[model samples]
Target: MKLQQQKYRLKLCQPAILPLAVLTALTASPILADETDAEKEKARVIEVIEVTATRQTENLQRVPIAVTALSGAELEQYQIQNLGQLEALVPNLNLHVGDAANAVVYIRGVGQLDSISFNDPGVGIYLDDVYLGRVQGAFLDVVDPQQIEVLRGPQGTLYGRNTIGGAVKFTSARPSETTEGYVSVLAGNYQQRGVKASLTGPLIDEQLAGRFAIAKSSRDGFSFNQYTGKNDYDKDSLTWRGSLLFTPVSEFTAYLVLDGSNQNPDYSRTPHRETPIYSLPSGDFLPVGEDPFVVNANFNDREELRTKGVALTLDYQLQQSTLKSITAYREMNYRTHLDLDGTPDASFGIYSYEDQDQLSQELQWLYRSESLSLVSGLFYFRENSWSLGGAIAPDFFVPLGNGVFFPFPVISAGLRDQTNTSYAVYSNMSWQLSEPLSITLGARWTSEKKQVSNSGEEFFGTGIDTPQGMQAVFGTGIGHSLTGYDASQRWNDFSPRAVLNYQYSSQTMLYSSVSKGFKSGGFNGRLTSFAQPYDPETLWSYEAGAKSLLLNQQLRLNTAFFYNDYKNFQLSRFSIDPDTGAFLSLFENSGKATTYGAELELQALLTDSLTLNMNLGYLNGGYDKLIGDFEQEVSDERELVNAPRWNGRLGLDYWFDLGSRGTLSVNAGASFKSKTYLTVSSSDLLAQPGFTLYDLYVNWQSQDERWQLNLFGKNLTDKRYRQHGFDLSASPGVQLGYYGDPRTYGLQLTYRYF
Candidate 1:
C-alpha cells in the first residue's frame, strides 16, 4: 500500500466499550449461594496475583501503578517465545526487531531508535534484577521464568536512569526445597525444532538447594533467497542457567546465579521490488524478484554472538529491618558481516565487531511495619567496551573515457574505546496518615563519568596499485590517514516522586502521583569528525489511577491516565548526502514535546467455562515545538516515532473436561494497532498502515498433570505486516522494510516427574 496519502484517524467504537462495561457490572454484583453449581463455578474463577513492582512483594490490586504481570504458565499459553511477542499482550507498547540481535521497544511513543554500543536504551531491560547493558543482547528468550513485569511510564525513582520510557523485569524461578523436573519438545513449520528442560532439588537437606535450566531452538528462515538458494533469516541458539541457594540460619541467606548463551543467525532482511530512480552507468535499474521473500544479493550475511554473566545476592534480617547486597558481572562478544547495499552487484559490504565487560554492586536496607515502610539503597557500576568495523564499497571505481578508469577507495574503517563509571543513592518511603489515607515519597541522586577515544580513516580515493599501470588516480593521500581523538564528560541528576493514595472501600483504591525520569548523555561513537555530544534527556510525568476487584474476587479492573512533559528530547536521524554519497548520522537534543495517554485492563469470569481478558490504550499528543537543520520550523509536521494513536487486544479462554482422562482448553485472541511512523523524520517511506492479527491455541492435559500437549497458531489469518522500515526516498525513491513472521503453526509435547 502506498503511504503518501494514507490517513490514520482514531476510531472509538461501541463494541469495544460495551464489553468492558458489562465486565465491570458483573464485578460489582454479588454471587448468591442459592444459584446453581454453574454460577458457583463462575464465581470461583478468580485467581490471586502478586507482583514486585515496588522491589517488594504485594497484592497486585494494592499497587498504585500501571503494570502488567504474566506468569510462566500464561506466557507459555500465549506462545511468548521471546521479547518481541510481548507487544501483543501489553497496552501502548510496540516491540520492533531491527535484526536478529537488536530491537527497539517503544512505550507511549518514547524510546531509543539506535542500537549502537555507545548509546543506551530509554526503556530498561532487567533479568533477575540485573540490568542488561545493551539492546544488542537484550532480546532474552523466555526459559522457565517465574514472572514477567512491564511497568509503564517514568520509573526513575526506583529504577534510576535509562528508564524514562519504563522498564521490563524478568524474574527466573529460584531453587526448590523438593526435587522436581520437566522437559518439553516442539516441532513446527519451516523446519522448526525446540527442546527445553529444567530440574530443581535439595542439595544438603534444608540447608542448600540448586536449580538448572536449558533451552535449544533452531528454525529455517521464512524468506528464501533465490540467488543463493538459501534461507534469508535462519536462527540457531542455545541458552543455559544455574542457581544455588544457601540458608545457613533463619535470619541469613545467600544465592548465586550463572548463565550463558550462544546465538548464530543469518541476515534478517529482503530487498524491495520497487525500481530505484537512480540509473547506473549501464542505464539499467536493479531488479528485485516479485516474491516478498526473494532477494537478489551477492553476500551471505551472518552473525555470531556469545554472552556470559554471574550474579550473587546476600540477605540478612534484623529485628526491625533487613539488609541486602547484590553483585554482578557480565561479558559479551559480537561480530557481524552484512551486505549493506542489499543488491547482487556487491556495491558495498560491512563487517563489524564488539567486545564488552561490565560490573555492578548494590546494597539495600528495608524497614516495613503496619503503618510505615521504607527502602533505601546504594549502587555502583563500571563498564569497558571496544568496537571496530569497516565498510567496503568496491563500486566506487568508475570508468572515464575510452578504456581509462579511476579505481576509487575500497573501505572506511572506524573504532571506539570507551569506559563508564557511575554511582547512585536512592530511597523510597511510605506512611499511613489515617485508616484510609496514605502518602509515598521517593528520591534518587546519580553521578556518572564517561571517557572515550575514537579514530577512523576514509579511503575514498584511488590507490597506487592498479592493473592499468597508473599512479594513484584519486585517493591514497596524507588526508586519508587514520586520526584519533579523546573526549570525556560528566553528568549528575536528581529524580523525585510523590504519591497520594486513598482506600475507598475493601475492594477498591484510588491513587495519584507525580514523578521525574532521566537519561544520561554520552558521545556519538559512529561519528568520524566534528563529533558532537548530546545532552541528557528528562521527563516529568503525572498520573491518576484506580485499582479494584469485584464479584467476590472473580473480576479485576485497573485504569490509568497519564501526561508527560519532555525536555531536551534526544532525537537521532540518518542522512545520505545526494552529492557525496556519504552516510551520516547525528544525535541531537530536539525541542520540547508533550504526550498524554490512557490505559485500561480488565479480566472477568463471564461463565462457568468462559473467561475474558482485554486491554485498551489511547494516545493523542505529539511534538508541539521542533525544528530541522538550518533552523527550519517543522513543529507542526513532526511527531514521535512508533507512537500509534490506538492499540488494543481482546482474548477469550474456555475449558472443558474430556471425560475422566484429561481436560481441554482453548484460547483465541486478536490484537490491533493504528498506523505508525518508524522514524522521527515522518517520511512517507517510513509509514505503516494499521493492522490486526489473530492467534489461536489448544491444550490437553492429563488428569494427573503428568503429560500434556499443545497446538498453536500465530498470525492465523495470514496477515502481512512490517515490523520495521528504512527511508531512502531522496533520489532512489525506494524504501526497505523488515517484515513480521507469516502464518505459523506448531505442536508441543511435555512430561513432568517429581
Candidate 2:
C-alpha cells in the first residue's frame, strides 16, 4: 500500500500552544477595565446563553454537558448561512456536502457517510424539536433562528434516536406580541444576490400572534464545464417559515409552525478529476483533469430538492410544573443527474430520485423546585422512504480466457423502499444534595423496527452494436435481474447517563459524566444479493469539564476532556463483486475503536469596546481492531476519517462609538485545521492538508438601531482546500475531489421597524 506524503509540516503542538498560553496569562491577570458605572454600562460582558440540550431550558454554564450555543446575532456576525459553514465555530464538529441533496455531518469522528435511504445518521439533527428523518432535508438555510446548539459526546438519554456521536438543535424565533419586522438585501461577487425578510405581529388583542420569514439566494457557478460551455456547481434556493401562537388563558398556550424549502441548482455534483489519465488493460483510456474548478462532463442537469414540514406544540403551565406536547410531519423529494466519469464521451453517468416522509409525536413533563429539577418525555416516530437510481458505463470491459477481453458495456438500475418505526421513553432528574453539590441520573429505553425491499438489474454486452447483435445477447438490450431481496430487523437499547456537579464558587463549576449511546443497524441498499444484517453500533463515553466566569465577569472559559469506547463500528466502502467483478458499495461491522479528545473555549472582554474569542480542539485515537472484507484482520495504521489532530479558531471584535451617528464595529477571525482524511480507507490522494482560513466583517448601525449596513469577506487569503473526495481508481481508474468555496466578498443592507 502507498501513502501520500504530507504537503505541510505536522506541527502537532503549534496550533494549541498560542491559545493555551494566552488563556493562562489572561486567567492570571487582573481585570483590564475599572468597575466604574460608565465603564460597566459600556463594557460588553460575555452574555449569558440559554440552551435546550438536556431537553429542558437551562443556563448554558449550569448544564453538565459538553455543548456550544450560538445566538442569531453571533451567527450573522460570523456570516454562517448554512450547516456546512459551521465547521469552524464548534469543537470536534465536521460538516460537508456530499451532493446537491445530501449533507454529511460528523462529530468526534463518528458519522454515517453513505447516503442510502436504509442507513441512519450517527449525528442527529433536530429543528424546532422535530427530528429530521433524512440528511437530504438537513441542509436548509438558517432563517429567523433564535439560537443553535451543538451537544457533543453521546446524547442517548435526552435524544433517544441515533445520536451516537452527538446532536444539533436549531430553535427558531417565536411569535411576538409586539409588531416588528426587518428586511435585508445582499449582493456580492459571482453575481450573488439575496433577500431575507421577517415580520412578527399581534393578530388579535393579546390573544393571538404570528411570525413569517422568507429567504431567497442565488449565485453563479464556480466551476467551469468545458463540454457544455457553461458553469457548474451553482446555487439557487428559497426557504420560508411561518408560525402562529394562540393563548386563550395565561396558563395555556399553543404554537403551530410551517416551513418549506426548495433548491434547484445546476449540475452541483461535478467533482474535478484528481488523477492522471489511465489506460485500462483493454487498451481503453480514462480522462482526467488538472484543475479543481475545471471539468469536462457530457451530462448536465439541474438538481431539485423540495422539503416541507408542519409542527404543533401545546404547553400547559401549572404552579410548579409544565406539560408539553409536540406533533410534527415532514416530507422531502429530491432528484439529481450526474456525470461520474467527468468526461464528454458519457463514460459513466447516473440519475437518482428520492421520496421520503415522516411523522413524530412527543410529550414531556418538566418540573422544578428549590432543590430539585426533573424532565421526562415520551417519543414516537414513523418514516417511509423510497429511492430509485440507474447507472451506465459504456467503456467497461469483461475478461475472456487466455488473457483476452471484450467490450462489455455495464448498465444497472436499482430501487429501495424502507419503513422505520421507533418508540422511546426517557427521564432525567437532578437532586441538589447540598447548596454547592448535585447529582443527576437519566435513562432511556428505545425500540425500533425496520423493513426494506430492494431489487436491481444489470446488463452486460459483448461488443454488441447492431440490432441483430443485441438480439443475440438478450431480447431487448435492457438488462437481466441481478438482485432481489426482502428483509426486516428489530433492535432495542437501554441507555443511561450519570453526572456529578460541584459548584466550586459563585463563578466557577465542575462536572463529570458517563453516558452510553446506540445506533440501530440496517441492511445495505446497494447490495447484489441478500446478506446478513449488520449489528447495531454502541459507544460509552466518559467526560469531565469546567465552566468558569473569571476576571470579574470579564472573561469566560470552558474546558472539557472526553474518552470514548466505540464497538461494532459500522463502516461503508466500495467492494468488488466476486461474481461479476462490478463495484459494490456495502456496509459491514469493522470491530472496536477508541477515541479521546479535549476542547477549550475562551471569551474575554479586553476593553470596554473590545472582545476576544478563541477555541481549540485536539483529537487522537483510531481503530483497535479492524476486520476487512473476507473476514481477514487488517492493519490499524490508517488514521480515523474526519478526525484532525489539531483545530482552532481565534477572533477579535472591536466597537467604535460615534458620538451622534451610531456604532462602527470590526470583526476579524481565523480558523485552522490539521490534515484530514475524507474516506474510511484513509487514501492519501483524497486527503486535505493543513490549512487556515481568514474572514473579516465591518458593520455600521444608525443611532436609532433601525438601519444597518455591513461588508463581509470569507477566505480572505483564497486558500484552496478540498471538502470531499471519491477514489474510484479500482474500477474507473479516476480520483475526484470537491473544493471549498473561494474568496468571496459581499455587502448587505437592512432596515428594521417596531
Candidate 3:
C-alpha cells in the first residue's frame, strides 16, 4: 500500500521509506539445524580443524595462533547460520549497526568502524584466498558451509593487506572424488521456508569428479508495516559449483574450482519496538499490539542488490611440501532508492545509491613443511563504481496533490567515478629452533593508488545543513550540479612482522607477535570541503596469546591481549551538501586513535556425555585529538561508536545414546552484547544502550553415518532487539536500527550416499 499523503509529510517520507524496506527484507538470514548419522559420524570426531592462523592444518590445540574454529556441525547444532550466529561461537566478535544481512564485524575490541566504501574494509574476508572487499558485500551469498575460522590479532605476516583487524576465512564443502550428493527442505515460524540440494562424484571414473548445489529461503518481517500490506522482508538465493580433479601420474595432480551465488532481499522497517507508555526505552522486544512506535506512518525502504562471482584454484604437491595458485573475478551491483518517510525525515526527500563492484586478481604461493617453511605471493586488484543521490530534490517536503512524490530539488543523478588499484609482494618464513621453540618472520611491500571524479547534479543544501554538507547540497535542482574534482595518490609501505612460538607440551602452545597493517587510500565519494585526498589508514599491532588443553583433553582454552597504534584512520562523516538535502559522505585523514583490548575463550567437555564453551571480549578504544573542524567530526569522536565495550557467549553440547540405533545430541547457546551506539558520534550516551540475546538447538541421528535430524530455535525467548540504525540530520531522516525478530523454530533432515 502506498503511504498516505495525509500522514507522511514529504520530509518524513524521504528518509524512512528506503531504510524500512531494506531492513525488513534483510531480516531473513540463513538459519538451519539438522543432521543424519553419516553427518553425525563426521561431527562426533572433532568439532573443526583450522588452518587460517598459520597456513598449516593442525589440531586447534597445536596451532601456535589465537583462533576460533566453528565446525559444520557446530554451525548447525547452534542453528548458528551466517556471520550473525558467530556472536555466540567466537569470543569478542560482534556485528553492530545494520542487520544480520549487512554488518560491520569487530574483533579484539577493534574493527573496521564506519568503513563502508566501494573498495575497502578494515578487516578482510577470504573465500579460498580471494578477498571480498566491502564488508557489506561479504554478507550475501552465504552458504551452509563445511567450516569457518576467525583468526584474531594482526595477520600482517602472510595473509596479505587490509588485515589489521584480523581475518575471517570460509571453506565451502568440496566435491568428493568417490561419491555423489544429497538434498533437503526446511520450514519454520515467521513464515520461514527453504529448499536446498547438491550432487557430486565420478563423471569419468577415477579421472574426474564434480558437484553443484542450490538454496532459497523467505520469511515475513517480524516488524510488520501495516501500510505496505505485505510482510516487510524476504531473501532469495541460488549457488553453483563445478570441479575437475585430475591425476595424470603418480606425482603430478591439479584441481579446478568454479563457484558463484545470487541473493535478493526486500526488507527494512520499524514496528514500535517497545513502549515508553509501558517499557519506555529503546532496547526491549515487544509485539506490535503492545508498543507505541507501531503506528503505520513510518517505514524503512531500499530497492535492490545482486552479488555473483567465480573462483579457481590449482594445487601441486611433492613428497614433503605443497604449492598452489588462485585466480578470481567477482562483481556486485547495488541500486537503492530510500524514502525515509514516517517517523522522522526532517525533510531531506529521497536519498539513493546506485553502484557496482567488479574485481579480479591472481594469487600464488608455496608451502612444503610445517617447520622451516616459506610462503610468498603477488596480487593486483581494480574496481569501478557510480552513485546517484542527494537532498537537492525540492519535491521533498512539498505537498503532493495526487500520490506522486516530488523531492525538493531532485538530483536525478549524482555520480562519483573512481579507479582503485594495488600491487603487492609478500614473503613469510618459519623455522624450528628446537622442538619446543620456533621463530617466524614476514614482510610485504605494497604500491597502491586511487583516482576519483564527480559528474552529476547538485540538489541544493549548501554544505551547511545537509548530510553532504551545505555548499554542495541543493535548494533548487537543475543541470550538471557537480564540480569535476579529481585526485590520485600513491603509497609505498613495508610491513614487517615477527612471531615467537613455544610448544610447552603436545597439548599447549604460547606465541607473541609484532606487525604493521594497512588500509589503502581512496577518494571520498561524498561531497567534500577540501580538495585534498584522504591519507591511507595504518596500524602498528603488538600481541601475546596462549592456547592449552586441560583435564585430560576434556577442555581447551585460548586468550590474547593486543595494543594497536593507529594513524590517519579513515572515518566516515555525514553532512548535507548545501546544494542537496542528501547526506554527502566526505573523508579526512586527520583521524587518529588507539585501540587496546583482551579476548578470552574456553571450551570444556563437562562430562562423558556433555560439553560447554564460553567466550569473552573487551575493548577500550577512542580518539586522542580533533580530526577536523566539521560538524560531523564533533559527532564522530564519541566512543568510536560500534565498538562495544563488552561481549560474551556460552554454549553447551550434549549427546545421549538412545536404546541402540538412535542417539540424541542437544546444543544450546546464548549471547550478550553491551549497549552499542549505532552512531557513536552522537552527543548523548543515552541514545544507545546495551542489549542481550538468547538461542537454542538440538539434533538426533541414527547410529550409522546415514540418517540425521536437527531441531532449532533462534531468538528463542522472542527477545526484542535492534542490531543497527542511522538518523540523518537536516530535513534529517531517521532510519531506526534494524531489529532482531521474535521466536523462529525449524527442523532439518539429511542422508549421505557414501
Displacement of the residue 252 alpha carbon in candidate 2, Å? 1.4
Model 2 regions lying over 4 Å from their true place: 1-36, 39-44, 160-162, 277-287, 397-406, 459-479
Better of 1 and 3 by lDDT: 1
lDDT of 2 by residue, 643-717 (tens): 888898898876655534555566789999999998776789889999999988766665577777667788989
Please, what are the lDDT tens digits per residue for candidate 1 over residues 1-754? 0001001000000112223343344334443224367745644556667898887788888888889998777777776788888898888998866743676888887788776778778888888888887777788888878889999987766753348889889999899999998888888888888898999999999899999999999989888876688888787999999999999898999999999999887654554433442223344456545666666665556677888899999989998798989899999888776554467654545656788898989888888999988878898888899887656666533334343434444566677889988888888899999999999999988898888998776654534222111212222343266666789999999999999999999889999999888888888888856467888889999999999888776678889999999888888766555455455566778788899999999887777557788999998788877766546678788877888899989998765545334555667899999988876678655577899999887666655677666677888888877677655443123456667888887877777777
- Best candidate, lDDT: 2
Better of 1 and 2 by lDDT: 2
Stretches > 4 Å off in candidate 1: 1-43, 160-162, 266-283, 287-290, 396-410, 459-479, 576-581, 730-734
Q: In lDDT terms, how accurate is model 2?
A: 0.78
What is the Å distance of residue 413 in model 2 from its true position?
1.4
Q: Return the TM-score for candidate 3, rounded to 2 decimals.
A: 0.82
The per-candidate count of clashes, in order, stands at 1, 0, 125
RMSD of each: 8.5, 8.2, 11.0
